[model samples]
Target chain A: MRKWILLLAVFLAACTTKPSFTSENVYVGTDGVSLAFTKNSPPAEVFENSIFPVGIEIWNKGAYNVEEGYALVNLDQDYMEPGEFTGSTSIFPSDASKLDFQLMGKSEISQQGDRDTIGLTVLTKPIDILSEKHTSTVSVMACYRYQTFASPNVCIDTDPFGIRENKKSCTVSDIPLTGGQGAPVAVTKVEVKMLPSKSQDKVVSQFRIYVKNMGNGQVVDASKVADACSSEGLTKSDINSVSVSAQLSNGIVLDCIPKREGNGGLEGYLRLKGEDYVLCNYEEGVPMELGTFKTTLNIALDYGYMHSISKDVTIRKSAVI
Target chain B: MEQKRVFLGVLVIVSLLIIGCSGSKGNQPTAVEFRTGSSGLDVTFPSGTPQQIFENDIDVRIPIQVENKGAFPQFDELSEFTGFLWVGGYDPNILQASFEQGDIRKQLDPEELEGRSSFNQQGGVVLESLILSVGDLPLGTAVYEPTLIFYLTYLYKSIASVPVCIDPEPRSINVKDKVCSLTDFRKIYSVAPQGGPVGITNVEEIITSNQIIFKFDLQNFGTGQVIARDLVSSNPNEGFDWRDLNRVQIEDVRLGDRSVDKCKPDLGEEVELFQGIGHFQCTLSVASIASAQAYTTPLTVTLTYGYAQSQFRNIKILEAIEI
Candidate 1:
């Protein structure tokens, strides 16, 4: 009896022990839709005949079912539709067309499994897209129903697209279209005149330089010019002593008054007595290019001032009348 | 009367038997036999015997292994044992020499010796002798192995004659004086900023106000103690100033800053300064001073320090600052 009781107790203890069960489930689904484009031909040179043949593939990586979908290859607009399409075509628009683009066909990729892949090809003739060089996007969109056991089916839509481009228009051109000439300067004209002053034995010849629109661009203030005689070099005192005179080309001797009532170059008048003006003597002898007697007439203009044209005139002793 | 005589005779016989048994007990071998050599407990020297000098101690390892060869299980609980080293035939006079005179003659007293140095019982019995002074032993003298005897107690009975060999022979050393003297001054001139001008002075002040430091390297040139008094500077006029004649000094100086007095050299224990090279700096403070008067005198510093009864000199002169 005791043997039987022991066996029973052992059996009871074994039966009272609880058993545990464990299980694991793996699930994989698509997250969203994606679109990619492959070029069929090499890019065209800047001013050449080139056609861009592109193929686009849209992938839907989700556990949902897509009901209706469309892909539009429109310029400056969105492409969304549902159907089957083999390919599409577009002509690169001109300026008269105002940078417009068109879509031809549509294709549909039925949601068969958790992931569905759709492919579309776009063969576009070489268009002069460089006329309005800017960015354009080709988009693909689809609407699908998302279903799960824990929740009712939910409908979601998405549009994914890739860009087709003209390589020449996409990159900055190295050749500058304008303004390659050196720094521009503004000036109406420059005229030099010699007028006689008082004395006869020593003709007081006055050299005048007419500066028009003096303080215009780039060529502004004048640098100091050295005289043939002065050994110490030109000082501020020498620069200040020189006088500038302004006159009209029509011989209307206007008042030699400064425009701003200052000693500036803008419509300024300056005078030098014949004795005060020393003619420079060249030891190597003056070249024919330089007149026999040379005197520097320095006029200070505002910063960045330039003269488009300049002329020089000289007056000397007359043989006889 | 005859019966009484027979009884007495029997008693005499019993008494003789008892006496005989007591006599046999005395004759039984009191000497206990223990396994020796590698077969039993063994002593291993990590450094394979050491040749040490006077007052030098080395670690001696004695590995003990106990075997119960008896039929009945025997629990030998050796709580404590007495081990003794018998260094026989050593000249007592040599063991009595003074250490100061370079004599190895000195007796290492048991009371003054550390117990651990000579006795170990917890894990395999091992004992190392304390620092011994083998007084004035001739060179190439052989130090014999001392016999080690361990008194073991088992089952409350004391047993002697557990013999152990001193695996390797003890160290024998000849005493001699160690003399050290400064041989050369390796002047690792501080880089441009730190190095002083070798010939020219005054053109430009060294950016860093580092002194001309001289590394006085002393070599054990002679046989002596290299006594503290031996370190004497030969150039007394030079700035070879040492705070303590016994210890070397490191001098550090910065431009415009006062020279820091003798910096102590870091010497670790067990590392005897047999060849000591001290760095002494001679600062060019005069050149660093802004005023012309400061450099007018032109400072020339020479250092002299005593080293092994000889004088070492390090001379440095500060020239004028050019600008």
Candidate 2:
């Protein structure tokens, strides 16, 4: 009887704990969806004018379920033609419009994420065999929508000058980060500063958040996820584009300013190319009376990521005349 | 193999340390740090200057103290052109300097006035004395007060040496592992700003394929007004205008011998500072660098601008009772 009572009490305590993505260790890792060429699927060598199949296995290592039409697989058309496969498709489509629909993500109950496969069976076009053979690289690209969320306890010192005699909870200093927040685009650091405002009496809380692309794929604009793998609508500007938003646990929304965007409050392109910083400030200046305290900073980065792996195959002329 | 990698890592780190230690090349630092203090000359009245004096007493003297609080006047660079100290904004006949010179128009030290540094925080100070005879209270029976302005003008230079990452091919076709490519290695190193009224506040380095651009934030980090090197004179009271307040000139911008060109606001134009804050952009050709990895190098920017400082003192003269 006593054992049962103790177990119920322990479970109740856990139920009351706050739901924090980082503290609770939910969907936490530096990696998102990863794709690789299945072993021996795309044979090492093939005969000219013959058909071959390219198989890729994608694993969703993150916690967000990828909806149908959200994950697109593309085939490199320069080397081979989808002769017998799904012919004449979207910008650069696979045998199917999208990968496996309703691909579930990692959950507490199911520790390991879902897995799916894509097959691009194509007919090799005749090529001029120089000497022994002509080798070609068959590349498969997987572009999918992903998000990176990081929640770290940050110091918000309203009384940075120590005007009051009361003891403070936290002090303001730069928060440096290592590893990553389980996304291709990761927040590297956050610089905390208490600046004097125009009024002189109030202190403005400003944070410089640094971000970088930490994946084996290319970053595409979140709005153009479908066309990322094909390079149809993707331009130089569209590449390396990421949307960013941040807020405090206390419901105080921050005004985020990217280097490219002069105005604050808007997102996207928060960083330039691979690395940059975004300047955000508490829209409402922290009053001096509140003293110092600690709060969780929730930073969200959204973007379309595409990873490609190619297998080289040597095609020998069937009948060398 | 592990030992080989460790040896290579140590070699790279040692090489970077050597590069960081190599400042401008020809010039070796005399002090621990150069950037310190805001005022070119910290002027104050130590002892000789008194607040009140009896009419016809004739024993009024003020020793004006001037300290080279900033790294300028460079005594050696200025030669004899350091500038002059003038006493204006008061009646000349009522109060004279030293009772012999008739007016206070004196040349500076004729010797070296060293600026402030980490080793010598107080810097070099020079004292100029003024012997005055308080005249008979304007012949009127009461107390008279006059606000005296001690004007100081000198040519000063503010130089900022910043460490920047130079990628040979900023926009290379294929990206690989480089020293400064990682965010952990790329951090803002806040060395002291070269000391003066006008200072380079922050530097933003942007790396693109063909070009390496830098945006430098300019600020008047001092309490005095910055005068254009050409416009700074002994007495700007009679000939000064609004145009002289925020004017500065870029003397030299270089990375060792290679000149950083394609600068915004041009090179020779009088760079006007808006408010206390202003900025300029300059680009370095990455084509010159043929290395695969990014290396750290020093970017030295020299700016020549004149600074004007004034300290005011109010004095009262009371009529002596006729015995």
Best by lDDT: 2
Cα lDDT tens digits, model 1, B50-165, are 33333122222222222212111112323221112211111222332122233322122222221211122122333333223433222111121212121111111111111111
Model 2 per-residue lDDT tens digits across residues A131-182: 4567777766667777777655566665566543223334678887777765
With candidate 2 superimposed using the best TM-score fit, by how many Å does residue A19's alpha carbon deviate from the native?
81
Residues A1-321 of candidate 1: C-alpha lDDT, one tens digit per residue: 999999999999999986874221111221323334434311221211222332344444322233322333332221112122334322222211111111111111322223333333323223333342322343322211111110101100000011110001011111111211111111112222332223321222222232222122112122322120112334433332222332221121233343333444334422222222212111122122111121212222221111121111111122224
Candidate 1 local Cα displacement, residue B296, angstroms? 99
| lDDT of the candidates, in the order given | 0.24, 0.66
lDDT of model 1, residue A65: 30
DockQ of each: 0.00, 0.00
Q: How far does residue A14 in candidate 1 sit from its true spot (Å)?
A: 39
- Cα miss at A156, model 2 (Å)? 52
The estimated TM-scores of all candidates read 0.14, 0.43
